[model samples]
Target: MRAPRPRAILAVLGVLLLTACGTAGATDGAERATEERVVRVAAAADLKFALEEVADLVAEEHPDVRLDLTYGSSGTFVQQITNGAPFDLYLSADRGYAEQLVDAGLAAPEDLFSYAVGRLVLWTPDGSALDPAPGLTVLAPEDAGTVAIANPEHAPYGRAAVAALRAAGLEEQVRPRLVLGENVAQAAEFVRSGNAQAGVVALSLVLADPLRGHGRWVEVPVDSYPRLDQGGVVLSGAADLGAARAVREVLLGAGGTEVLERYGFSLPGS
Candidate 1:
């Protein structure tokens, strides 16, 4: 075969280089475009419904970003995170637990902040079940068979329940009748499920549709316990730190704040 002219060989090489560059660029763009980020969020059980609402709202705007939420007592969630549960964010029902994560260096302390102040409520489905007039006074020590409370050892709501009972002068009376739950949501379930005649639960849970349809409740006096300052933090090992940050903004944003309020949660400023 005759050797190709220098100009012909140079032109062919140039064409090959251009084609390779185009293909590489397309591949790079495809890889970048195909990458979708997911953020795992660990939330308190009391926030199950509220967080679900916010998740739905965020999903409308961020199709590529997803929220993977796990709900439980704050203590349990914190323990999970410390054990490397791969959560990107943590929302605790109490500021103390969130601070514990910050102190343990499991979370980014700078990102730690309180979102809401939880309220405990005394709820009952039957208005006339034991009342002179439907109130906390009726579930007195002599009257309660089973009064549900979150586990005070781990659940912030449980701690509040203890405090509320103590303040109302019903602790001793209700003590023997107390039935513990793992978290505030479950505490509400005890009362709603009729496992316990009445219970102390987070106001948010009692206000949820299922509970609302099932009963009526009184907001436990704020004077009873230290404020249930619910807080959140961004985890250090999150894959999409930016997305996590976006989620924080949305949660603290007006829309999220509004949802929290309607669910009986008190906001930071309020």
Candidate 2:
């Protein structure tokens, strides 16, 4: 081919550079479009079933947002968040814990909202000879073996279990037979796995599918323990505040309220 003039070659080079830049920009835009919005949630173990359902509903509406949930004792989560854990939101079984975050300036006071009221249940695996009904008096039987409860020091459900036992005057009799789980969910597991003959767990957990028909439960009288006013708050250090708030709404809105109710949770103020 004949050599091109200097101007012609310069013009071609400029076009090539512009095309490369355009292609690069398009690629960057595509990458940004596909980037997922992640919301890290620190939730109480009692909320495992209900929150998972809420997450599914949230996904249906906000596919770009991914909810990353960490379930554990509410007290433990409070400690973690206070120490600057990168969680985007906190859902506590005890409302007080979420309030504590606000007091510490880790979360906005206005962002805190009560989501549900948890109830305690006395649960025993199916086919168990023990009858949890009538009351905690069943624990007095000689063959009761062990009763599993979450660690009262950190798990809100555990505290309620203790309170119920005390109210029923069974604390002394059941004290020696107690086996502590790290959280309420683990306490339910202890009973399911036959490690403990019976347990006191969140009513929401008992109403969940796998456990709902797998065992027998008696609702502990509400008067037996302090009400479990569950609360949630958006964290101050959230990577995406809007996304975090969106997830929070999913738990507090109609869809979440229905799911929570289906799982045996009573809505706050209901």
Candidate 3:
């Protein structure tokens, strides 16, 4: 076979080198690509802005990790999680849902913990003629054509809103004027859009920049309603428990606490 030509030998060597280089480059690329692990989070609508801020901070330290948050009413989130929603973490605005998940064998109680103490508030758009004093009486019929609140059946914040009104002895006077929102954030929206004279919403919702620029708020007396203890847990089917745990830590960590505090949330027991 003429012992193979010299050119053929060179060609074979070139192919081998190119193949080795390509493999090396591919390996390097893979290593550099963000090892982002998707951690699906079922969060309360009230937590929309606060959680996003925490997620951004987490991304700074964990460029390879990303939080996929599904924001809605706490009860709705609980139902979805029970139905096997693709979530690695659950952050409810109230403890009831998290406790329910634990009791239902859907979440591991050992992994569950309170993340924040949800706060409620009365919010109104700029220049609105509403006074949000503690234990304030309901406005006259003509003064409050509508007062917004989330649907109590599915939103923890909504329940809190009702509780506050009841505590203030305004429920009977205000119930007929109540405008139901799908979530606390939506209740805030009802005020922001001038659809309601005033609204009860999560303090975080009104504290968030978007709403802050459009309105003013006053903290509802903490004593008026049951404590809103928000909690979270790692899902049973998490593909990356480590990532989920990291996110949980970030939410419970000092940095996370600061972020929450900045947005009107308080640390558990604080």
Tens digit per residue, CA lDDT, model 2, 153-178: 99999999999999988898898999
Off by over 4 Å in 1: 1-35, 126-128, 132-134
Model 3, which residues run further than 4 Å from truth?
A: 1-33, 140-142
At residue 211, what lDDT does model 3 achieve?
A: 82
lDDT of 1 by residue, 125-240 (tens): 55527432345677884655688899998899999889887887888888889989998888878887788888878888877777776666777779888888899998878888
For model 3, which pairs clash?
A: 36-64
In order, the Cα lDDT scores of the candidates are 0.84, 0.92, 0.85
Question: Model 3, 1-270: lDDT tens per residue?
Answer: 569999999999999999999999999999877567999988889888988889998898787899988888889988887888888888888877888988898778787888889888887777776766632464545566688999999998899889988988788888888999988888888888899988888888887888876766678899999999888878777888899999998888888999999998888888
Candidate 1 Cα deviation (angstroms), residue 148: 0.8
* Residue 266 accuracy (lDDT) in model 3: 86
Write down the TM-score of every candidate: 0.86, 0.94, 0.89
Q: Indicate which candidate wins on TM-score.
A: 2
